[model samples]
Target chain A: MIGCGWGLVYGVLNSLSNIMLLPSAPFISIRPQIALPMAVGILLNPPAGFVVGFIGNMIGDGISGFGIWKFWNWHLANGLMGFIPGLIRYFGIVKIGTVREFGILQMSVVLASGIAVAFAVLLDVCFLHHMTFPSSFPSWILPAFLTDAVNGFVLVPVILLAFRKILLTLEIRTICLVTILLLLAVFSTAVSITLSILDDLVSQEAVIENFYIAGIVSVFLLVVGFLASVVFVRRFTDPVIRMSRASQEVESGHYDLSLLDPVSSRNDELGRLSRVLQKMAKTVQERERSLRQQVQDLQIKIDRKRKDEEVREIVETDYFRELKKKAKAFRSS
Target chain B: MAKIIAIHSFRGGTGKSNTTANLACLLAREGYRVGMVDTDIQSPGIHVLFDLDTNDIPYALNDYLWGKCDIARAAYDVTKTLGADATGRLFLVPSSIRAGDIARVLHYGYDVTLLKEGYRQLIRQLPLDYLFIDTHPGINEETLMSIATTDVLLIILRPDQQDYQGTAVTVEVSRQLEVPEMYIVLNKVPVRVDREALAAKAVSAYDCPVVGVLPHDEDMLDLGSSGIFSLRYPDHIISREMRRIVQRLTP
Candidate 1:
C-alpha cells in the first residue's frame, strides 16, 4: 500500500516535471521530480523506491497517452535509478554524519543516473535494433543522464534535510555548501556550452562532441575541487569551532574539558589554545573552591584588619603607655 | 611568695569575675593559698560569685583605698563560702558595693598606685600563694594598674568582632607592661565554633597564646553571674574549661 501511494505521487511528480519543459533543449524538461524516488530509496528500502519509480513513470506516460509498453525500458531505467541509491541503506549510513557520507550520498545519485542511462542505451543497441551511440547520444542518452544526475544531486539532499534525517553539523554544512556551489558551476558551464553549440559553430559534430566531453570533465573537476576545499576548511575550522564551544562551557563554570582531546593533540596554535583553556578552567575552579572556604570563615565579611588598626590607635595612647609603664615599674618593686 | 594574677577584659559580660572566682576557688580547693581582690572598684561583681552580700563586706577595698582602714581589714576569708568540699583557704578583698560608696569612689578616684600597693599588702598579709585581681572591664587607670603589676595576666574576651579588636589591643598593652606570663581565655563562645581555628586565629591576631575557649553553657546563662559556674556545675564544659584555665595559669 505504501509503495502504491508513493507510486501515485511519483506519477504525479513525473507529469509535473514534463509540464516544465527545458528552454535550451527541445525534448528535454527540468525533471527535478526525479529526486522523489531516489530520495525515497535512500530514506526507505529499494523495493519501495523501484515500485514508485516504475509505476509512477508508467502512469505518467499513460496520462500523456503515450505507449507505455513501447517505451517499457525507460520505466525500467527509472526503477533502476531508485533501486540503486536504496543500496546506500546497506552501507549502514543511518544518517549523514560527515562530509564523506554526504559526498557518498550525492555520488550515488549521479552514479545511478549513469548506470540507468547506460542500461537503456545498451537495450536499444541489442534488442531494439537501434545503435544509440551517434544518434540517441545527443537526444536521449546525454539529456537523460545529465538532467537526472544534476537534479537528483541538488534535490535529494534538500529532501533529506527537510526530513531532518541529515543533521546540520559542521561537516554537513560544508557538504551542503559544496553541493550548491557545484550546482552553480555546472549549470553555468552547461549553459555556455549549449550557447556555443547554438552559436553556428555547432555544424562540426566533432567540435560539439568535444565540447560535450569538456563540459563533463569540467563538472567532475568542479566537484573534486569543491570536495577538496571542504576537507581543507574542515581541517582548519573544526578545532576553532570546538574551542569556541569549550569556551562557552567554561563560561557556564563546567570545567570538565575532556572534549578537546582531539583538538589539543594537533600541535597547532589552536591545540595550544585548547590546552591553555583547559588548564585555566581547572585553575579557576580550584581558586573558587578556596575562596568559598575563606568566605565561609567570615560570615559577616568584616574588615577585621582595618578595624584592628583603628582599635590599636584607640588603645595605644600616651596615658595607656604611661599607665603601663607605671604598672611595669610597680611590678618590679 | 604570692603570684599576682590579674584577670581583665576590654569589654563587660565576658564572665571575667566568674572566671576569677572559679580560678581562685579551684586553686584553694587544690590546697593552694589563693587570695582574690576585687580591684574593679567601680563595678565590683566577684563577691556575687561567693554570694557575699554588700552588707557583709565589713571593711571594703574602698575603705582601704581611701585610707579609712588597713587593706587586710577588707580581705574576707571566703573559702568556707564554697561549702565543705573546699579543702584549702581562700580570701577575697571585695570592693565597696554600697550605692553611696560606689559613687564616692568614682567621684573621688583613688590613686592607681594605691591599688597596686594594696595588691602587694593583701598578698603579704594574707600570705597567699596566688593573689588574683578581678579588674574592671576596659582601659581605665585602675584596670591598667592591675594589669601592669601582675605576674600572670589572663585577658577574657568573647568571640565577637568588637571584642576581637579590643582583645588585640589588650594583649599588646599587657605585653608592653612586661608581664611574666599572659594568656587569652575565650568566653561565651557559640557551640558551633571551630575551637582550634578560633584559638589559632586569636593567637595569630593578638600574638598571645590562648589558654581556653569556654563554650556558652545553658547552665551558665541560668546561673546569670550570681554563683560560681565551676562550683555549681563542676562537670559542665564551662567548668571543665575553667579548670583547664586554672591548670594553665598555675603551670
Candidate 2:
C-alpha cells in the first residue's frame, strides 16, 4: 500500500513535470521542479516516498501511453533522484540540519531537480527514442531546465514547511501517515483513471478527445492526491501550531495559556503535535516559576534594606544623646 | 538489511584502521560478506593491511567520489590473503594513497551527501552483511555524518590522558547525535597496568560498555599491516579478544 501510494505521487509528479515532451524553446514550466520536493519528501519518509515515487512515476508514464520502454527509462532516472537522496539520508551524507548549514537547500533542490530532469530528457532522447545526439539536446535542454527550476522554486518550500511542521510537532507517526496517504493516493488515482476509461468507452465522442479529457481529469486527481495528503497532514498540524504558540506565550511570562484537552490518538498528526505542545507548556511553566522566585528575592532585599535604615537611624540618635550627657557632666565638674 | 558499522575515534593513533581491517576479516571468517571503506581520504592506509600494494589498487575511493568510477569498481576482494577457506568475502574500498588525489580532495571537499549515497549504493550492490567505515579522527563533517548514520559506533582508545580526553569529546558528540548504541574498546593497553582496573575506570568515565582491552602485543608490531592478525594467528590472545568483539557484533 505504501509502495502504491508513493507510486501515485511519482506518477503525478512525472506527468506534471512532463518528462514525456521535449520542447524546443528554453521556457520554464513550474511543474518539473516538483520532483525536488517529492525527492526531499521521500528522503524524510523513505519507505512510502521511495516506493511511491519510484513505481508511481513508472506506472503514471506507462498509463499515459509512453510505451513500456520509455516508462522504464524515465522510471529509472527519476527514481534515482529519490533513491540517491534517500541513500544519502540513510548513510548520513545529508544530515538533518543541512538546510540550516548551507542555506542553499532550496536552491540545491532546484539545481538537482533541473539535473534530474535533464538526465531524464537525455535518457528519453538518447536511449529510448534513439534521436541524434547533439541535435536533440538543444530542443530538450531548455524546457527541462525551465520546468525543473520552476517546480523546485515552488514545490520544495511547500514540502519543506510541511515536513518541518510534522517533525517539530510530532503530529503524526511518519510511517503511518505516509502509509495512509499513499493508500488514499493510489485508490483515488485508480478510481479516477477507471472512471475516465469507462466514460470514454460508453460515450459517442472521438476516442482521442475523450482520452485527452480523461488524461486531464486523471492529472487533476493526481493533484488532488497531493492535496488530500496535505489535508490529512493539516488535520493534526493546526492544533500543534496553536499549542506551540500557546507554549511560546507561556514562555514569554504569560502563564495563563489555556490547558485544553490532550489530542486524541485517532487525531493522527494533530495528536502528536499537541503532545509536544503539552511538554513545551510544562517547560514554560517551570521557567515562569523560576522568574517569579527571582522577583520575590529582589523584593526581600528591598525590605531588608528599609529595616536596616530605620535601625541605623535609631542607633545614631541614642549615641548622640549619650555623648551630650557625657559632655554636660564634664563641664559641671 | 545490511548493518552499517562505522569504526571511528576522535583522535588519531587509536588503531582505527587496524581495528576496522581486523573486524572485517573476523566477520568474513564467520561466513558474512563484509565491505570495508577507507573514508579517511587525507591519510589512506587500510589497503596495506590487506597486502594490496599501491600498484595493485586499480581504483580507489577518491576516484568514485570524483565520479570517475562506480564505488564497486574500487572494491578489492582479499579473502585469500587471510589464509583461511575463502568462503567469506571481504571487499576493501580504499582511499587514494596518491599525494595528488589526497591534495585535491582536501583543497576542495566533495559533497558529503554524495559520499553517503555511495555507501548505500555499495551495500545494495554487494548485498553486504556489514559495511565497515574507517573514519578520520576528531570532529569533522564526515566523521560526524558517519556517526549519525551508524547502527553501531565503536570508539577505539588507548589508556593515555590525551586519548581519554579526546574519547570523551567523541562520546559526547555521539550521544548528541543520538547514536543507537556505542561502545569503547581500550586498545594497546600496556602489560604493566592492571587491565581490570583500567577497564573499570574507562567504563566509569564514559558510562558506556567496554567491549575489549587489547594488550600491546609484540607479534602485532612485527606483522604490522601486512596481514590480518586474527586470521593469521587465531590461537593468539589478541585474536581471541578480537573474536569476542566480533561475536558481539554478529547478529
Candidate 1 per-residue lDDT, tens place, A273-317, comes to 889988998999988876675445433223667756855774578
Predictions in order: lDDT: 0.80, 0.67
lDDT tens string, model 2, B13-104?
A: 77889989998988887788999999999998888887777565789988888899999998888778656566778888988888899899
lDDT per residue as tens, model 2, A97-176: 33342234445555555666667777767666754566755655555555555555445545655665223334224433
Each prediction's total of clashing residue pairs, residues at least 3 apart in sequence or on different chains, is: 0, 13
Interface DockQ of each model: 0.22, 0.00
All-Cα superposition RMSD per candidate: 11.5, 36.3
Q: Give the C-alpha miss distance for residue A142 in model 1, angstroms.
A: 3.8
- For each candidate, report what fraction of the true interface contacts it reproduces: 0.38, 0.00
